[model samples]
Target chain A: MSHTTKEKSKLLARIRRLKGQMEAVERALEAEMPCGDILNLVASVRGAVNGLMGELIEDHIRMHVVDPGTETDSERAKGAADLIDVVRMYLK
Target chain B: MSHTTKEKSKLLARIRRLKGQMEAVERALEAEMPCGDILNLVASVRGAVNGLMGELIEDHIRMHVVDPGTETDSERAKGAADLIDVVRMYLK
Candidate 1:
């Protein structure tokens, strides 16, 4: 099995949590929660989704673009690191 | 400015490509493309999305869970590496 298949369960768990957070936002809306409260819930869901996205993007760069373990070009390595840093900041 | 903000243009370019891919799928559907062709287009879109997600998720782990730079614990580093491998595999 590929690394992803082996780790599918953990990834699914994170997705499930995101789903639950989204549901919470839905529930808050259904109950007619205060605008500020609903906004907070929505923001929470957004953050969770962003976090999930960030994790996946980082791996892609490491595996496909530049594996720090094997990459030798200092300039390329710095670029990859910079991209990763930006991705993290964007998600936040 | 945050790294993300600084890199926003490049990130946005990727997002636009994804959007264009999605639109291509939609156009194919509207043009009454064969099921196989449509399926291929859809698969392309899915792959693009997975790639995007993978990049984001990898960055998240590095930034929040275990940045390779400062992390010193061998066990923790191994775990992070393992997780990143799985994420890359899964997204593939």
Candidate 2:
């Protein structure tokens, strides 16, 4: 996957933020934070992760499913299969 | 996205098998399998899940990156950005 420099940089920043979120959860667990609070933080992070996944999946499908350019039959079929599998796994 | 009926059927079957594997891990834990055995089963499930993720990612990237049709400029850029974000998140 290719991206403009700024887009790549922004995404890298998001990943760093996500890493920090993960660390916060670890710290909360180790510090014996209240279970409810810790779980709340975890749920927030999971939502963020899922948001990222939905964006990724939407972009991928739009590119492949909506506008697969002059690709071979097998490749087009593969894109379809990928969409089905992704929806099956993540939507579940 | 479309596939032949047989192809779709096969993929669905694989997903069902994966679901069965997940259930086996749950049953192993509840049945008081040895700690080592339980951990091993968990690890196996994790590996299988990662394998599925890799396959899905590969197919998505190939379709979007290699053969995106005459998509709008923003759509193309978004696809690139999505790929970068996915790599950043999962490859870390």
Candidate 3:
């Protein structure tokens, strides 16, 4: 089974939250909120999105790249570590 | 600047790749590809999406949660580490 399928409900909950955040941004825009306020609202929505994305990526890494728990292969572990390192560096 | 904006071109490239993968899935469906093959194509798209999401999350962490390089505040570092731990656990 796909990782997403395994965690479908949790993923959906996060998505729903993201949707709500997006809707908030939309409402702010519609209401002609101040630009700064709108920008802040948009930033929150983006952060929510990033959180969701981070969760998915971590799941993908576990499912496809390496399962940190049972992974005994050094090469594969190294690969996963490398990927994580890149993620950190890129994020920085 | 928003991390996304700072890395706009790179992000766009990743998005373009994802779009291409999605288009391939669409094409496979239209061409009556075997179910297994279509499923594989969909998986590829999902992985691409996961990659993109992972990058965004990392960026968000760097921009908002903690800048690993210059994070001098122990409390914030702990908070970020806690978040990363949760991310790893959830992903697993």
TM-score of each: 0.46, 0.42, 0.47
Better of 1 and 3 by lDDT: 1
TM-score ranking, high to low? 3, 1, 2
Best candidate (score: DockQ):
2
All candidates: interface RMSD: 10.1, 4.2, 8.9
DockQ of 3: 0.04
lDDT of 3 by residue, B1-92 (tens): 56656665665555556545545645554555544464465555445544555556666777856975579998888788777666545432
Instruction: Please provide, for model 2 over B1-92, each residue's C-alpha lDDT reduced to its tens digit, 9 standing for 90 to 100.
Output: 43333246756776787898889888987897899988887787777767666554544554434333443556554554555455446532
For B1-92, candidate 1 gives per-residue lDDT tens digits of 33346557877998999989889988988899899998888888888887887776666656644665566766446656766686677565
Can you tell me which runs of candidate 2 are displaced by over 4 Å? Answer: A1-33, A63-88, B1-33, B60-92
**What is the full ranking by DockQ, best candidate first?**
2, 3, 1
lDDT of each: 0.72, 0.62, 0.58
Can you list the residue pairs that collide in candidate 3? none
Local accuracy of candidate 2 as per-residue lDDT tens digits, A1-92: 43334257766777788889999999999999999999899998888777666655554554434344444556555565565456546532
